[model samples]
Target chain A: MHYPNGKKNDQTQKTLANVSKSHAFSNRGMTLEEDINAANAFYRDTGKASIHKKPTPIQVVNVHYPKRSAAVITEGYFKQPSTTDYNGIYHGRHIDFEAKETKNKTRFPLANIHEHQIRHMKSIINHGGICFLIIRFSAHGETFYMPAETLFRYWDDQINGGKKSIRYETIANEGHIVPFHYQARVHYLAIIDKLYF
Target chain B: MHYPNGKKNDQTQKTLANVSKSHAFSNRGMTLEEDINAANAFYRDTGKASIHKKPTPIQVVNVHYPKRSAAVITEGYFKQPSTTDYNGIYHGRHIDFEAKETKNKTRFPLANIHEHQIRHMKSIINHGGICFLIIRFSAHGETFYMPAETLFRYWDDQINGGKKSIRYETIANEGHIVPFHYQARVHYLAIIDKLYF
Candidate 1:
């Protein structure tokens, strides 16, 4: 996506906004990230939640001063995040979670998550924050909210030579479904309200 | 600081750690950011807090895939942060704050913060989270914690043609002093304990 002359500013953000807007009428074509971003925007506008996705961490190697006012990163690489991507306050509770979309129909692979991320989620739960995972099954067009405590059991079992994936039936039985809405999109907060608040 | 050939990893983070280590013997040479980062690390290690400094946001304009596994950002620019730099859970409560250092002797300029950032801080406070500003006066070798409510009064005054900066004397009177320590360099949670829980 090359920026036009004099339009180099906010190309990344604009690209995301454009993607979200292009599929505004229906969410069938939108990615999970786009839907959550749109949902977060709606939550912010309605003063229901103040969540935000942290910017992707990057490590810059060399920078070039093309002009006095512009410093361009000539070489950089993405860094693995040490914590969950999205977090903020909700009704006085610290809300933290990671969201992922999978096309797998039968089971969700634990390989989709990193070990450190599981540790971070455990820490958030121990600290009494509302922590969970938002898993979107693209094949079924369904999103489910699995509490950190529930996920920890499977994670611990996986560490002890058990199955490497959680069956979709287990997730459906243990996790609450996140209904889609026109404005809220993913509508995970509705599940949070039922589970925690 | 340029990395040696084939040693390009976490250059920015290493630069900060190098700065922190070079000034380890004394607090005199440490920047506010370095000190706060040190404090946050100590807090995390001790399990007293789970705070983290949000990564610097960047607008990636272009990337080059020289190899299949690694993608390098070829052109990117810095993006202004939408909220405070640091936030996490503390003692089962949400904590959010921004830290700034000013070399000015008498006044801390309000221009150091953006208007939207102020609005974000206010929203955090309204949501029942603990939100404040950590201001470092290098000339005085002191840091003050100003609550969002206290800062809002001055912000409103600035909107009505008041002074563009807060006087050092006024800050000293209105804000709590953050003590410096060996391990917890900034020692802000102590002030938080005194004011809140």
Candidate 2:
């Protein structure tokens, strides 16, 4: 599959298709973003949590209604998002996060984040919301729920001569590893129950 | 002054223009959406709140950058928003609201709201967020903060025999009156402090 812009995959070692067959999991499907979205919807429907993905804000410049049956959005430019991706109430506490999937097995690069997003995350923390990042190492099939507080520490340390990227070992030590499932795909909230609630 | 859509104002009242004189006033006298955006920015900067106006999603068909400095978005159509106008955390509680300003003096019309927004607000309330509407009766020089719970009750009651439009008198009694100011233009958070905190 063609990766979106700003993503770097190890083209030499292995492809995602190869890993799926090795694992022998027929349910090895869905993008990380889609899974998390499904989980959120399930959570909301079950009266468990009410998080939602903010609609991707695109400035559409052109559309072609070919036959009135379907409207094709032809020309549009991506607008700078002014806020975090996902936000909602969970157990009467506000929850906010930005989800990203990386192909690197060794480390998740900080370049995946924008400076404005860091500022936004800090503001979310200051306002007393449960903030975090969902990092999925797609190649190794590992996902970690790293809290904003931990992210803040590393982000600030970068300014003071810390590592440019967060290693898998460091993430394993500090971040909660999320379990994958058939229904509620990411299942990060299960970790939230054990760690937070 | 003509509105952004080039619609001429029918009422002669100059409330918004007069209110925009102060340096702290928001939007530099733009649309109601602009004022709310400015208020949100101020709120975020001061660590007061995390509310944001979701950008109006648009489908673009064409863009012509005739000049290097100016990227003219030539052809675009608005997309129906899937959520409420503003949502964020305020002092550990989830805050969600939609804002609308009307020139109508005696009653606030319900037609200004999309059915989907009403559904979204209901979901927000079901999941424990504080949901409401900021109704500004510009002609009367009054703004009222009406809670979503109350609005829902009225909406449900309308099916049984309640009034279609909420009277100004009813709004004055049931809603929190928002005070206008130089810096905090809307100052709706003052009501939030009283009601939620």
Candidate 3:
């Protein structure tokens, strides 16, 4: 098949192999995305909050509609998102945050976050919304909720030729360790309640 | 091309004709979507507000990476969105809304809105977020901002066999008439300032 942009779908064989490898990894355990999705569902179902992860942005090049079926997108490319992963309202306050999981045990690399995402977070904070980062250290099975203010300080330092990553100790001291529950997998709201409310 | 769900993209040849008809109409002037996009850009540029139209959701069926440019989505289906089109934080308030346009001269059809969208709007209102609908009567060149509460009342009435569409007169009475500005095309926020803030 050819896209409207004339690109051929000829690498499907190789892509399927990559897809299987990722499927294998997902089959082994829950990913941070899955955990956060579950937590968001819990919050919604219980009327605790109304948060949602925005759909991954895609730049559609062509769409084809069948006679009796839904419209099919034949060609597209995943677009880099310019905002945070999750956002909603809690207690009349706009809540915005991004979640990331890393295998690194010593420090959280700044490369994990995009400059646009940092700018988005800065805008959210400036608008008086509650903005933060939920960082999960998978190696140590720990999650921390670091306020955007703290993150901005580190990000600014990096621009000034400072450390490129935040030390594990710094995050441990400054960020709130999010508690995990069976239903609410990543219970970051509990920390929000204590800190903000 | 076929979606993963075994749907073929065979109707494009027929749909293309219908698309051109709509394109011809849109070519006359700016579409409601374009106007709102321009207004959003103006709002962002002036630091007046931070709002964005959510990206259209596409359910990927197949993807291909040709070891050159970005990964190409070879097959996908356009997913029905579960929430409103536009949402963001405005002055510490969670702003959520959907915009629709109709050519009908007298009544705005409720069919333009989906069931899930109403449920999502209800949830936002329950969570204390600011929610509304922007309806444009293209035939009359008029736009109005109808609060979620007013929309819900009409929606519930429809369930009880009330009017299937809201009359233009009723909208004029209950909704704020949004004025047009050169820079901020659909100046709905002006009404928001009076009604909300």
Candidate 4:
């Protein structure tokens, strides 16, 4: 960020307001999650897709129910998610995918993705659900939709002592680029339309 | 019933531990959630389907990341889920549902089903996803599968000066019973198979 994380952000926001909304959005430095959430909201509002992000899995060990207020989780631990973070029905097909952002422009390290998650994605694909990954290269501001099949290849190669990451060039050539827009920051359904519909 | 307080609690915990290890679907007193989870586990293990219960939505306010342990959610509140609790794919179709158990023998109350959840179900059905509710009458020990389409009729009726609950007899007559099995305790997919496949 050009300025400190404070009133400077709002000050710059106003200056950027004079520019295009999309241009402002990129300069504002919204995370990939924020962009995808905005895209999901747009898709939902337009009746294009019924996609949603599944809640972070938390194992609640204890809860305190106050007299009139909501129940408060006193002791809880985040659990490893067995499935991808997002899924829904799109065009009568079961759509499932996990999204991640990497600052490294050279490659995406596979350490963040767990083995059980890979198994879950494989199961989804085996059951005829559409599964993929949305990888955003933060340094390059490029997001690519890599199918689970393609990811499995790299994952298996990694398991067998291959390179630990998927090269950015390989993804750029093999994966579909998710377009960005003012309303849908990551208009990924456009890529899905071309690939599936 | 005759045991003392502390001993009874320990015995109960031990019984639960044993029940979990042994696939004892014949065992009594399993909650609707446990039954549904067992059914989902069976489905996943057998490669029959890939359904899963979505994690309870929690709004985490504060977290404590200790030096050696995993992050602990120190302050969090339960969130009202906009969508149903469980959803996945079966037979190449998206399956979405909310499951509940009622001890009341006369009827199932409408207070628990939120308006937004009903709207989400409608959208899921509109998008060609298989949507439904799994209602279990704990007193009667009978579980029924009620389609979202049918549930909407009752929901709309209740919205417009109708009864606040669905009569148990009405459900027994119109809804499909979800058979209990040794492995898949709920065995709800059986009803889906008969209805769709």
Model 3, span B174-196: residue lDDT tens: 99998889999898889889987
- Which candidate do you rate higher for DockQ, 1 or 2? 1
Off by over 4 Å in 4: A1-28, B1-27
TM-score of chain B of each: 0.88, 0.77, 0.87, 0.86
Q: Is the docking of candidate 2 incorrect, acceptable, medium or high quality?
A: incorrect
**Clashing residue pairs, candidate 1?**
none
Runs of candidate 2 with Cα error greater than 4 angstroms are A1-27, A59-76, B1-29, B58-77
Fnat of candidate 2, please? 0.39
Interface C-alpha RMSD per candidate, 1 decimal: 3.2, 9.8, 6.3, 8.7
Candidate 3: lDDT of B15? 51
Top-TM-score structure, candidate number: 1
Please give the C-alpha DockQ score of model 2.
Answer: 0.22
Which segments of model 3 are wrong by more than 4 Å? A1-28, B1-28
- Count of residue pairs whose backbone atoms collide, per candidate: 0, 9, 0, 0
For model 1, report the TM-score of its A chain. 0.88
Which predicted model would earn the best DockQ?
1
Judged by DockQ cut-offs, is candidate 3 incorrect, acceptable, medium or high? acceptable
- State the lDDT at A54 in candidate 3: 91
For model 2, state the Cα shift of residue A197 in Å. Answer: 1.2
Window of ten residues with lowest summed lDDT in model 2 chain A: A1-10
True-vs-predicted CA distance for residue A150, candidate 3, Å: 0.5
Selected candidate, larger DockQ, 2 vs 4: 4
